[model samples]
Target: MTALSDAEFVVRTVADTACANEEYFGQLDAVVGDGDFGYSLARGFEHVLAQWDDFDRTDAGVFLQKVAQAISQRVGGTSGPIWGTAFLRAGGKLKGHETIAPADVVVALRAAVEGIQARGQAQLGEKTLLDSLVPAIDTFEAETAAGASTDDALAAMAVTARTTADATKELQAMRGRASYTGERSIGSVDAGATAVAVMLEKLAGAWPQR
Candidate 1:
């Protein structure tokens, strides 16, 4: 598939998955936050889906820029900017590409993770989204470097994302409002990390193997 089609499928899949899991995310947030993370993410993606026709699908970079804009503008919360910046950074790396390959995917994920780290000043084991994303990227990179297929690499990444996200349940929140919970946060899975896992899992399922 062309990069544009692939981008469309990815955006649509994430939007659908986020919207479907909105309430659950909110519940997780309620355990440690204002309980609106799911709502904001769902609304942001819903806006993206609504404006799908306006995106310049022919250009992957343009498509993602528009998506980042929509999310940053419409989504109400810190998550909006963090996620938007991730997409923006990843998109920027594909500026001249008409089609993206598995290597491009790895580069994009790496860029996105760097963007998040820069924007949030956070890292793994802090009970943030990075907990899911970092491990996923590591697994994907290792698998791909070992000559795995795109499908196999993505499957490994998804597994790492799931495992790491679940492991957040054992960590005391060290970032965001969840951190305010102190020891109380130890037993709950991080809402943001859960979103990361969901996004990765959905991407693994939706991405086409050329």
Candidate 2:
């Protein structure tokens, strides 16, 4: 597929995934943090989808850049900064590429993880999205290195992302408002991580057909 088509697929998948899990994320947030995460994510992706026509007219890098700006403007809370930074960094990694290769996907994942880390200043095991995304990226890279196809690599990454996200329930919160809850944060998955898992799963599912 063309870069523009791939990006469009990603955007649509993200929006749909977010909408499907909005209530679950909201419930997760209500436990140990502010309960607006679901709404914020939904709003951000909605804005992204609304601008799909405009993004389709641009290159992959510019398309992602526009998406970042749109999400940053439309979404509230840390979700805006975290997701915006992910897209912006991924865009930078894809700059000047007419078509994205499987290796390019790995590079973009690394850039996204770095961007989120830089923006949130949160480390792995912090009960944040990094807990999921970091593992997912690692799995993607490892699978790719083993000569797996893009579809297989992404599938492995999605499974790891979901597993890691679920595992976060056993960890204590070390950042965000959830940290304030101390031991109470345990037994509940991080909302951000859950959302990331959902997004990655959707991306992997869409990759094969695309």
Candidate 3:
């Protein structure tokens, strides 16, 4: 059983990843964006981690809702609202659950993907975070449906996310500031996609099942 405490660890792990990669992400964004995504997300998650001890984390829903709230309140730019909505929608699906099972995680991930799509009005192959996140969730759901353990499913998610993020370098930007760069964006990775990949990879590593 994955407890709320375990969820905290995953968030903390992602926060650590965000902080460690902030400069790298900033560099990625510098070519086409305001170059503040890394700093915004790092500070937002830092705030969430700092207040984690005071959150009502008896269940996954409450815990995730608080995390969503922190991101929305502390982070700026399109990434904040999009990420906040993803967490908020996903957490809503897990309401009333004291512990999240592997199946519950599947439901949450689906909701998160849907929320991100709805909020961003973006789709795969658009060189956004969805480029990485959608494939990871699809791989995870497929693996789990095929009788993979939580560990294996999560591992697949991490691997797929990383690969997808890297592949973004070959994709032309179709959204956000990067879109304005046209072919210039093709050789550079999407900063948002890279951040999502890092977070997913770290979360998989911190999973209780691992």
Candidate 4:
């Protein structure tokens, strides 16, 4: 598939997954963090789906640029900027690419991780989205290096993302509103990390190959 198609699939899958787990995230966030994560993600991705008709007509980079802009404008709170930056960085890395190779997927994922880190200024073990994204990227890179296809690499990455997100329950929050909970934040999965894992799973599921 073309890079544009891959991005479109990723966006649609993320939106769908977020919609499916909206209430779960809301309840999770209501306990230790702001309760807007689910609503914000739903709204942001709703806007993304609304623009799907335009995706195939545009270049991959331009399509993602538009998605980033739309999400930043429509989605409220930290998710807007963090998710927007992730797409924008991935789009930047995909510039001028028609079809995305396995290596291209690796580069795009690395750019996404870097963008999230730069935007949130949070690192691994901080109980943020990085906990999921960083390990997922690492797994994708490792799989690619091991001669895996794009589909296989993404599948491995999805598993790593989910595992890392679940492991966040043992971590203390170091950023965002969750940080205020101090030790109370421990034993609760980071909503953002869970959301990232959800997205990764959705993307892997949507992959054309099994």
TM-score per model over all chains:
0.94, 0.95, 0.92, 0.93
> What is candidate 2's CA lDDT for residue 50?
81
Task: Kindly give the stretch of ten consecutive residues in candidate 3 with the minimal lDDT sum.
Answer: 1-10
Model 4, span 1-210: residue lDDT tens: 677777677777777888788888888777789888888888888888887676544677778878888788888888899989988888888888888777787787788888888988988899988999889988988998999877888889999999999999999999999999899999999998888888888788778552
Q: Runs in model 2 with CA error above 4 Å?
A: none
Top model by lDDT, which number?
2
Go through the candidates in order and give each one's C-alpha lDDT. 0.86, 0.88, 0.84, 0.84
lDDT score of residue 24 within candidate 4: 82
Note the residue pairs that clash in candidate 2: none
2 or 4, which is superior by lDDT?
2
Cα deviation at 207, candidate 2, in Å, is: 2.1
- Model 3 spans with C-alpha error above 4 angstroms: 208-210
Error of 4 at 149 (Å): 2.3
lDDT of 3 at 69: 94
Total colliding residue pairs, candidate 4: 0
Clashing residue pairs, backbone N/CA/C < 3 A, model 1: none
Per residue, candidate 3 scores C-alpha lDDT tens digits across 1-210 of 455765667667877888788888888898787798889888888888888788777687878888999889988888788889988988898878877777787788789889988988899999999899888888988998899988879889989999999999999998887888889889888999988888887787777553
